[model samples]
Target: MGLYHFAKSLVYGLLKPVYRMEVIGTENFPKDGGVLLCSNHIDNLDPPMVGITAPRTIHFMAKEELFEVPVLGKILPNINAFPVKRGMSDREALRKGLKVLKEGNVLGLFPEGTRSKSGELGKGMAGAGFFALRSDAYVVPCAIIGPYKAFTKLKVVYGQPIDMGPIRERKASAEETTELIMAEIGKLIEVHR
Candidate 1:
């Protein structure tokens, strides 16, 4: 926990001024337990931007390419960020995410898979759904209002965690589960937009 705060302060100290972040709905964020912080991607800095806003430590899953860098590879892991293979069925990524949740840490995910080109939100993929089912972690839906630009008011609105009661009771199929998760995330994002 100390490491997390130290790393967060280091990052925020260096970048917060350059971004001039304006956070909202921070009161809605839970302060404990395993949580899934889902957000829309706008730029490479999106993960750090979203993660830093959480009062608790929030680790994010980034692309495997980031790990290839010499200095960053060493440092990113220390800050609780790791890489994932793109265009592959990354069970390893999913497992890592589940592990993070099971460890009672926050797992930050960009369900859109990549950054938004038109600065418009994309339909969320099933990665979030898989993580939810595997670990029983609550999904805390988030939205970033102005990440395309820099040093501006980029709002992060956190919606209430989802309820999977009926879906689990119904024994929802994978597709059903994925769609359900996607819909809930979409609805949350829409609320703040």
Candidate 2:
């Protein structure tokens, strides 16, 4: 926990002023315990934006390519970030997410996997929902409303936490649960456009 905060302070101090961030619904973030945060992907800055906004460490499932890089790899893992293969099942990534929750760290996921080229949120892959179910982590739907214009003021609106117990307990198919997860995220982000 000490290492987590140390890294967060270092990174966030440098980036927050540079981005000139504006975060909304910060009150929606939990102060203690583990959580699964699901958000739309837009900018590469998205993860750190979410990190500085939260009072806790938010570990993202990063791309394997990031690890191959020299500096980001070292800094990212220290901040609790791990890599996932681009197109495969990526069970190792999922297992790491499960471990994150087990160890009481906040896990961040972008259902779309990669950033959208169209400047819009694409159909979510639903793997995020399955992980939430498996870990029994409370899903917090988030919307990153426009750093489409980068140095400008951006809005990150987070909504109330979604209860996953009923669907998870029902042992529903991955498809059904994914729909619910996406639908809930859509609702929270409805006004972003």
Candidate 3:
């Protein structure tokens, strides 16, 4: 297997026993075409948890600082993780994300831009909505609900793809689309939490 799949399998093997991770609504994922997986972040483990559970490989836009870490910096790129500067527009990162989707790959993103300290879904940034409107990819909302206690259940729930047709046709602003995405994430958390 390739590095990404190998790492995913390894993580799954290790985390499954400890967290009793349960994945729901994976059937909601499309089998092919570009897909944007917009999820709410809660813990440091959120990215890997969602990556392993999703049916397809997810290329993530991780914080740029993560790339400066010693060993992890080298490993992240190999596992399909790229760096994105937070708290700014970061056009380069946005371009990279668009490129990933344009190539018909799955691009995983945390719409909230950072992890929540209180474990509640926070306001989403415009990035998720921007990508959805810019690309023809299916925008799938995901929720990672967990206290991440060992031997306890941690759930990753994938909600149905948000229909961007009407929004697109109406030429809705990215902020509006972001609100819709965050709302969908909230609903998923409500059902699965």
Candidate 4:
């Protein structure tokens, strides 16, 4: 196993029982090629929860602040996570995300940009759509619910890959494309709930 997979499995083995985690529709994940795992943000747990359960290694873009921590700084990149500046158009970060996709690796993105304080889905940022458009990669909508506390059931639902052909052909606005992605994510959340 790769370092990323090994780390995910080890962490997952420990946390699975604590959260009573269940992963649904993992079959929906494409077996190959570049794809985007667009999901809603809830807390710091969301990334690891989805990453460990995903069938493939997922490269994520975490907030730059998290990388400032001494230990996390060294660990996050080792696990395929890179830093991105939140609330701004960080070109370098976007370039990195595109590079991952171009290399035919899975890229995980929390379309909402940051964790939801209310634990409810928030509006998506344009990054997911932008990457999908530029890379011509399939977009998979994933929903992670519950897991708000210890002993609670944490469910992750992987929805079917969203076809962005029409949107890409028409050259849709980033806002419009993001709404569609968020809509798909919302549907997955409702299904898992």
Best-matching candidate per lDDT: 3
What would the per-residue lDDT of candidate 3 be over residues 1-193, giving only the tens digit for each residue? Answer: 9999999989989898899888999999999999999999999999989989999999999999999999999999999999998989999999999999999999999999988999999999999999999999999999998999999988999999999999999999999999999999999999988
lDDT of 2 by residue, 1-193 (tens): 5767876787778876666566777788777777888888888878877777775678888889999898877877877889999778888888888898877778998888889876576888767777777885667888887754636777777877887878878888766776777787777677654
Clashing pairs in 1: 19-151
Instruction: Give per-residue CA lDDT, model 4, range 1-193, as digits (tens).
Output: 7778788889899787789888898999999999899998898888889888899899999999999999989999999999999999999999999999999999999999988998889999999888988886779999999846888888889999998999999999888898999999999888778
TM-score of 1: 0.87
Positional deviation of residue 113's Cα in model 2 after best superposition, in angstroms: 0.6
User: What TM-score do all the candidates reach, one by one?
Assistant: 0.87, 0.88, 0.98, 0.96
Give the TM-score ranking, best first. Answer: 3, 4, 2, 1
Better of 3 and 4 by TM-score: 3
Identify the superior model by lDDT, candidate 2 or candidate 3: 3
Please give the distance, in angstroms, between residue 193's alpha carbon in candidate 3 and its true position after superposition.
1.7
Clashes of 1: 1
What lDDT does candidate 4 reach at residue 162? 95
Give per-residue CA lDDT, model 1, range 20-113, as digits (tens).
6767777777777788877877777777677678766788888898888999888878888878887777888878888999988889988888
Which residue runs does candidate 2 get wrong by more than 4 Å?
A: 1-3, 18-20, 148-151
* Runs with alpha carbons beyond 4 Å of true place in candidate 4: none
- TM-score leader: 3
Per-residue lDDT, model 3, residue 27, is 98
Residue-level error in angstroms, candidate 3, position 124 = 0.5
